[model samples]
Target: MNNKEIVAQAVYEVVEEQLTLAEVERLLENPKSVDHGDVAFPAFSLAKVFRKAPQQIAAELAEKINPDAFEKIEVVGPYLNFFMKKEVISSMVLKEIAKEDQSFGDSNIGNEGNVTIDMSSPNIAKPISMGHLRSTVIGNSISLILSKIGYNPIKINHLGDWGTQFGKLIVAYKKWGSEEKVKAEPINELLRLYVEFHERAEEEPELNDEARAWFKKLEDNDEEALSLWKWFRSESLKEFNKIYGMLEIDFDSFNGEAFYNDKMDEVVTLLEEKHLLQTNEGAEIVDLEKYGLNPALIKKSDGATLYITRDLAAALYRKREYNFVKSLYVVGNEQSGHFKQLKAVIKELGFDWSDEMVHVPFGLITKDGKKLSTRKGKIVLLEEVLNEAKDSALAQIEAKNPDLPNKEEIANQVGVGAVVFHDLKNDRLNNFDFSLEEVVRFEGETGPYVQYTHARAMTVLGKADFTVDPEAVYALNDADSWEIIKLLQSYPEVVIQAAEQYEPSVIAKHSIKLAQAFNKYYAHTKILVDDEQRDARLALVHAVTVILKEDLRLLGVHAPNRM
Candidate 1:
């Protein structure tokens, strides 16, 4: 156990007569001011249990308890404050970080557990846009968090590769698309054709019937329709792979809605067997008004399946195939109703494990306070945004250090890290405006600042040739050193909380706080001093480096050693 856990356990031993260990741990909190102490426990909740006043209870407890783990304890009004041996905590935290290195904050709490995460379900024949950024990075970071805690995470890129959209593409391709142009520039050409189809269909309303007929033919597996569909999918994937490579994202499964097409029949039959299906204007649906949701449409009047049908089939398939402990859908909050109905239908089908399924919804991206819409073509492509960030980073590097080695590689890391870190730093439930200028700034609580802090620590470590001895008396003689040590000792707890709460922003904020503390400490003290302070201060710098790197990794951002 770490120093905080040891201290908490020690406090439990002191107050075992009045409260359980869990309750004591829950009540233990970090003091806001340095003068208050390292940790504090409030006596307000225990007054009724002990049948005494809060101040009287605190004074009595302080007088009776004789704990050896802490250096001192005092009762300040209704609060019981604790102070630890500074040298002991500093030595313990530094030694633990040095021993574990990159894997310092990980735990085995989720051993042998399986998690399947669904994210980044972009439609075929359309380029990935800035709107898809939240789902992709948020899901990726959660997967990393789960894996750090020993859960086997299965990343799935559930592509949107079905529906009448493909029929519209097919109709547009035959009318205004050429084979050479499509083969040369697939996504752009397909987008042009798609845009043209909507434009012309406004005047030619019969185009809707033709599109529907083409979709029916494709569903029937017509050779001509299948050929076009396969080519579009193949070309789109090639472009998608380039983007994924740039982002360093990988998926264990690329199964999309089309993959579940043949599997949806069993769902319809099961719904019918359970008497969950109802007729609504010649359509098949599950009446969910009683459960405070709109009817879940299973099949259209024309016998075509809907999106929810495929989702239900996919959920069942994932359960039987992986038997996951948790299956998470990381999508936009606009689909909240769809997931509620999905879970309701699953529960009505007699599966009690429906609660294991989770829908992790996030807010949308906006430009100039207006929502970005892909259907109307008023969207920014993700590729362009990333490239722009890279260019800006390169320019900044040129201005700061024109002769730096491996400049291009470092620029790529800083650029991508800025964009990703900006998104992850905000609460997922709150919408954020996209601004390239603000995200890549080098000062303040930004990604480049954190990266620069790591680089600064690396430079200091390089200048010092002393060894870090955990057994030696490393005096953290100043408040700055003690502040940094306290933050370092709390890394493992912060990581665990982030994973449990499904919040990457927690880690983001923690990293920035640590960076700020270290920068202040660095400004006041010199690490390469001619004394015992050299080894002790270097040890602190090393611990800070290890923690910042791990935090960045959990947020799906890269930490560069030089910036």
Candidate 2:
């Protein structure tokens, strides 16, 4: 068992004598000092029931508790703090580090069932903008966390390869786009035509009707329309694959909106059978007024399927196909209402498992507190961010380590890793003011710093020949050693917490903390030569290197042995 679980269990044993384990867990508090205790249980909440002062109650419990595993118990005011034996904590830290390696932080808490994560769903024909980074990174990180624990994670990319937007693109391409221009630069040429079409659309409104007619023909599977649509999708996917490769992101499913076209009719029939579909004007909608929502439009007056219709059909299809334990939609917080209505409509159709559907909403990525929009052309390209980061990292390497081999390669890893780390080091609910300046600064609490720390530990290990054995005598009585050991011991807990919260930010923060602790320890103590104490310290450094490498890997960052 892990330290957190062990501590929690001990606390449970004490509280079970009085109240239920659930009640006791709710009343438990994190201890302020490891020196004072491993875990602290506050008696303040029980004061009213006991009819005694909290401090007095705590004192009584302290005396009554057997000092078997714990060294001592202290009652300070309403808090009962239990200090564990130093040797016990040190031994557990060494044993766990040696045994688990990369698996140290994993747990089986997610034994409930599989989790389906829908993320990184970039649109077709549009170049991936900086705005898409949040959903991609956040979703992938969450999937990593879930998989680390015992959850079966199914990653899906609900690519925007269908809709009225395609009609406009098709119209634009037919008018001004050329096959030669498309082959040369698919995304760029497609985007140019898309923009031009919208621009000319203002002067010639009839073009809109024409585009709609083409879309209708495409829906009816007209030979010409189908041929063009398939070609567009194939070319767009090819371009998208290049970017996904660079980012190291893959999806189990690329089921685009168009995949649900045939399924939508069945959904519409199901909704009609359930008497959930209503006609508003010439358009088809689901009257959600009773559910405290505005009418949800399923189909337009032109009989074209909308986003909601596709989403509804997709949801039903996924339920039948995967029978997923949980279906998570990693979307922006702005879409919370839409997801709520979608789930409500599904539930109304009698899908009992609809309750398991979750909308994991994240706040928007802003610049100077303003929302980013590609339509307004006020957006940064993700490729630009990556290039700038690499350039910045290369400059830093040239200044500090000019003699380092493969400098450009290392720079790419560090630079890209830094940007990814920064995005993940905060709660997903918090809006991020993305600043390239801040992301490239590798000085403090950053990915580069952690990578550098790992490299530093490797350097120390190279200077000495030492192997860490959990059976080796480890003393945490010294302040410096205790500090490092404490951080190492908390590694598993950090991973568990990150998995539980569905936030990779927790793992990112823990990596920085571990790196910071190691750096401080290295600066204070010498770890490589002729002394017994140095040999022990070298062993500690080796253990830390293993941990640093594993933690960075979890965050999808490369941990270069020499940085």
Clashing pairs in 2: none
The C-alpha RMSD in Å for every predicted model, in order, reads: 1.7, 2.4
Best by lDDT: 1
Per-residue CA lDDT of model 1 for 508-535, tens digit only, reads 9999999999999999997788786778
Native-vs-model 2 lDDT?
0.81
Q: Candidate 1: how many backbone clashes?
A: 0
Off by over 4 Å in 1: 2-4, 466-477
For model 2, state the Cα shift of residue 432 in Å: 1.2
What is the lDDT, from 0 to 100, of the residue 326 in candidate 2?
Answer: 89
After aligning candidate 2 to the native by TM-score, how far in Å is the CA of 336 from where it should be?
0.6
TM-score winner among the candidates? 1
